[model samples]
Target: MKIPKIDKTILVHLALFAVALIYGANYTIAKEVMPLYISPSATILMRVLGAAILFWILVGKKRLILSNKREKIILLLSAIFGVVVNQLLFFEGLARTTPINAALIMTTTPLLVLMVSAITGGEKFTFFKIIGISLGLLGAAMLIGSKTVSDSSLPFSFVFDFNLGDLLILLNAVSYAIYLVIAKPLLKKYSALSISKWMFTLALPFVLPFGFSDLGTTNFEQIPTEIYVGLGYIVLFTTFLTYLLNAWALKSVSSSVVGIYIYLQPVLATFIAVALDKDSLTPTKLIWAACIFLGVFLVSRK
Candidate 1:
């Protein structure tokens, strides 16, 4: 039997969008459950552990081997940026800001990734890319500005309050971009699953301190069952499955294409929030969504 040539570009983008959809559900679910069961650090710890376990199971023993010291170091660095720091910032940011704000801020990840890539010589700098990034930034500004202006219930003070959440999300984007840059070198040495597994393993130690502390503060018996269920979903779908798909996509496509898929996340998050959390679907969100998608399309076009 012969296998047909797969369009890796399409596959990567689609996988990323699918991950965004899963993550959309997570924003509502995680927010509700995370505060009830555990602190942000603990939540991240469990997620990393669960994702690692799943990756181990998928890869099995024979294929799990690391080829060299460089591979090991790369994996460690990837874990530091992608899992440990990125997730810590993201959860903390989520705790600080509205989910809508978090979502809107996350749309900037691709632009940041492109910039980082260009700076590092992973990708060439181009005038079109700059325009695309500007459009994305404008979209984000429009989204946030419109939201603040239209929602009378929102405290005017919030606009002035330094948004630590937005800052954390921005930090996550930078950390994730760094991880992507580091991973590119290691991907040549190891399979994506191997790299992912090692990264998770390294991240596990970093997460343990927070997990144990959070456990000490919370009463195990008093925690609601829904929290466990939500945690499980985040571990299985968002962390494990999403990473696998993302790695597969990255193997096949250019980083720019992979980055474009991030723009879809906020749109998916907004819709999911409306359907599940009783959040309003505003005209501002619609307009911002259009801007973001159009900008991403322009940037990603060949």
Candidate 2:
């Protein structure tokens, strides 16, 4: 008797699906814990530190060694874009903005990745890509209308306004896009666990300064159990599992395929949010979702 072997392509798709599922649910789960049970920055600190320890324990020291200065530099920069700026801005932004907005804005990542790759000479630009980018930006702007946290009644307004959190999430998308491009070569050379652990370890110094004070302020005992559960999800599933899965998938597929999966988050997030009563779906949200999906489809199209 013997166990049957699984297909690598199936495994990659499963990994990507798991990543999208974790992240889509994370939009609301993480939002529930931040700026209330714990500050956003402190949450980042916890997430990075916890994932780093887990990666180290899981991967061991053998794969952690680097062969060259260039790899070290790339890891450092990846830590900045991938861990520090990416996590910091996203958590902080989610603390202040709606989960739906975060989900919608994040649909731009595949387009951003394409643009970054083109600028870096890794890919060529085309008119269709330009149109896709424009559509994504338009959808984002529509979602950011003059609706404040207090203005819950105006769920789908189209008036122009700025939400700092939405803007930060946008920047987070850009940072993550840069990380994807910079870390592609590294992923091919190193085990995903090894790269992930090192990136989180290097991200510590930069993350600590921002999150340190908030870390001390969180009274863990007083927080509710659900918040802790949310925290654990962010630390374990969203941070560790998702990164490992993405890195594994990257080894088997193009980064563009990886980026395309981001479109799943909004759809999944919306369902989770609506089901949990954490958020609602409106006509405008549906319309924008369609626009975003179309844009991402064009960007990922050959």
Candidate 3:
């Protein structure tokens, strides 16, 4: 029997929701492995390698060959911005900054994406999208509580007294936003799995040098089972699955829509933490969630 087709819009939204949920858990899940069992460089090495291997295996010999060098260039840039810069900066930045600061800075990604897309002529700015991005950013601030800024994160006093680590995190957001915009054109011509697989594969070589020594020095036998489980989750679900989901969503939705869904990460992270008893549920959080929902709805409107 043939499987009935799912609506592309429904499928796209569902895929994005799954990506956000996976990322929400990843914030906590990844911590269980890094700085203890695996260094950030080594951890990223594992993420790229594991995801690369899985993607290659999933694609097998049926991989689509890009016929033009322009496609290769686009894919390479996507890999660098999406994986190399995005992951490495995040790890380094998070180490120097508190989660609250990182979360707030990262929430600016939607705005960055919108601005870049408009400037590049890839997207037309809309009133609803602007309001949506603003609302989502506000909701995120409310949920993460914007008051707790760490001094250590401030390395640069030249611009708004921003710290070095905070700058890196902001740059990471910018890089990923660029990746989404540049990669969107490719999505129109390739399967999400194929594009994702190639992006990770291309990213592997650039990332390998940074992580090799770290991975080589790690003591495997002494690492606990739980940490390994967390590592596996990062590689499989967070790295592999989320990328695929986002890519698939891109095939049907604009990059702005994909970017706006990031506002849900903190809201979902809060609820997940509550479920795990790592955090408490409060009325203020409920209000923030409503704002995020409204913002996402407005921004995602076609």
Among these predictions, the greatest lDDT belongs to: 2
TM values, all candidates: 0.85, 0.94, 0.80
Ranking by TM-score: 2, 1, 3
Pitting candidate 1 against candidate 2, the one with the higher TM-score is 2
**What lDDT score goes with residue 179 in model 2?**
92
How does model 2 fare in lDDT?
Answer: 0.87
Residue-level lDDT of model 2, residues 1-302, one tens digit each, is 99999999999998998898999999999988988789998999999999999988998876577889999899999999999999999998898888888998898899889988999999997888888877877777666654433346765455567789988988899999999998999999888888988999999889999989999988989999889888999999999999999988888888888888888888899889889999887777677767777888777777
Candidate 3 residue pairs in clash (backbone atoms < 3 Å) = 154-163, 155-163, 155-164
Q: Model 2 segments beyond 4 Å from truth?
A: 1-3, 145-157
Ranking of predictions according to lDDT: 2, 3, 1
What tens-digit string does per-residue lDDT give for candidate 3 at 1-302?
A: 99999888888898899988887777666655777778888988889999999998998767678879998899999999999999998877666554444554566677778778888987786999889778866765554443323356663211123366666777788899999999998988888888888888889999999999989999999999989898889899989999988988888888888988887776676666656764454444456556756766676678
Deviation of model 1 at 158, angstroms: 10
Evaluation by TM-score, superior candidate among 2 and 3: 2
CA lDDT scores, all candidates in order: 0.75, 0.87, 0.78
Error of 1 at 17 (Å): 3.2
lDDT of 1 by residue, 1-302 (tens): 99898776666667888988987777777787667667887788789988988888877774556678877677788899989998998888787666666777777777778788888877775778778888877776655444434356743311333566667877887788777777876665568888788788889998888777885776768778887788789899989988787777777766666666677777778778877763665555566667766666666766
